[model samples]
Target: MSKIKISNAVKKYGSNTVISGLNLDIRDGELFTLLGPSGCGKTTLLRMIAGFNSIEGGDFYFNERRINDIDPSRRNIGMVFQNYAIFPHMTVRQNVEFGLKNRKIPKSQVTAEAQRFLKLMQIDQYADRLPENLSGGQQQRVALARALAIRPDVLLMDEPLSNLDAKLRLEMRQAIRDIQKEVGITTVYVTHDQEEAMSISDTIAVMKDGVIQHLGTPKDIYQRPRNLFVATFIGRTNVLEGEYRDGKLRLDQGYLLQNGMWDKIGDQPLKVSVRPEEIVIADGETGLRGTVLDSIYLGLNTHYIIRLSGGEKIELIQESTMEELIPAGTAVNLMVKKEKINLFTGDGSRNLLRGEAS
Candidate 1:
């Protein structure tokens, strides 16, 4: 196991900056994920760590040793790419043992090690099958086995399961986490899939505009987002436009909300974020009173779109399997949980709910 440290990292192309003054410490043997949208510099940072992209500034360290000048081969890091880089002519066992062959390990020991990881990846049954003959899930297992065959200090995966179908993605996610834990390898995964990162990672780093907005556990990143981009991007959210008037929050349509506790926010126009799951839609709730515009049933739950009296749209999720449901144009009470309310300024930088009890 090895801890990875990125110190004051900066990456630039010509005059364009990709990453700016980033600092993070990844604990040994923990699954840390870099999560963001396209062009957010996540892949750039990952490539820098893999020595595929040279850093314009800052140092990269593995444990106590700095590897800025070290070659990629000497970094002792394993990487699995999005495209399963399996050779068409090679069988599953042969592909998994390719790294061992390059290092010129004994033939007998190589087979033994390949079998070991094949079993670990649960692909030992497909050892003799060619890449073309195996399923997508099976091929991914072989790719993982190939990476793990060399037993590198850290494993880096770049959207390895993105190509798989939905059901296969879920299965692969579990398999990846299971093998990662079984091997106890320090892993860093880069993906734009928030659900994937949240489901498998010990901690996630949320990035935007080439800068890290926040880095914390999955729950912290999801439930208590630091900025507007993160709050809106991580999941479905309801952003209410309001201003603090004498400490009380008032919506755009003269509707007032109790905010005597929000002292730090003296009198600023604040945009509050509430998840669809946080707002309670019942018969006589406070806050925004809205009329249902549409309600769509989704297997285990139903989603409701509310057109607020202030003309703002709010989403509500109900887990009930009740067939008798609310319809369009029906008025429903909207109540946002004070504990789940995430308040931010118009710029979406300041977290107004930081000091208050919830």
Candidate 2:
């Protein structure tokens, strides 16, 4: 395992800069994920670390050794592309052995190492089958086996599960995490799927427009987002615009939020982000009043769309337990969980609840 460091790394095409000056440090044996939407520079950053793209500026280091000038072949990094990249003409065993063979290990040791990883990837039963005969998951496993056969210093994956069906993607993601842990390799994964990154990564960097917006553990990123974008991007949130004045938040609908609410906020107009599951709805005279606009029954939860008295719309998710669904046009009282609410200034740059003890 190697500690990868990138300082002020920059990538540009002609005069257009795709990756601005960025700095990051990935620890040894850590499963770090770069997560963002399309064209957000996640893949570009991964490619730079893989030595596939030239670094226009800044330093790239592996284990304290400068590797900016090192070739991709000499970097000893294992890359699993989105397409799996399995050789079609070879059997599974042959494909896995290809990397070891290219490195010119002893013929006896090559087969042993290849077989070890094949079994590790749990595709040993189909070792003799060709790629054409394998399913998508099997092909992905073969690709992983091949990448690990060489025992690389770092493993980089580019949305490796995006091609598989939903069930297969889940299965393979778990398998990938298991294999990575068993081998104890430092891995960098790139994906746009928030849930997938949260499920597998030791650390995640949420990027936008060639820069990192948030960096934290999955729980930190999800439960206490630092900014409005991170809160909305990582999960479902209802952002309400309100005015803060003299220890009270006056909603546009004329509701005065005073007691039993988080009011220790700056004296400014701000937006409140409440997760759908954290908002409570019930039959009560107290709490903010709203009219249910719509309700959809999902298998695990029932989602409701409610319009506040001030005409602002918000969503609430309740666990599916009761048989009768709360129909639209029903008047309901809403209360946001005090600890679960996140406050952001009007510009949406900072979370006001960060320093306060919940």
Best by lDDT: 2
Give a tens-digit lDDT track for model 1, residues 143-256. Answer: 999999999999999999999999999999999988898899999999999899988999899988788888889898788888888899898899888788786877746766
lDDT of 2 by residue, 68-143 (tens): 9999999999989989899899999999999999998999999999999989999999999999999999999999
- Provide the TM-score for each candidate, comma-separated: 0.95, 0.96
The residue pairs found clashing in candidate 2 are 253-310
> Model 1, poorest ten-residue lDDT window?
349-358
lDDT of 1 at 223: 80
In model 2, state the lDDT of residue 57: 94
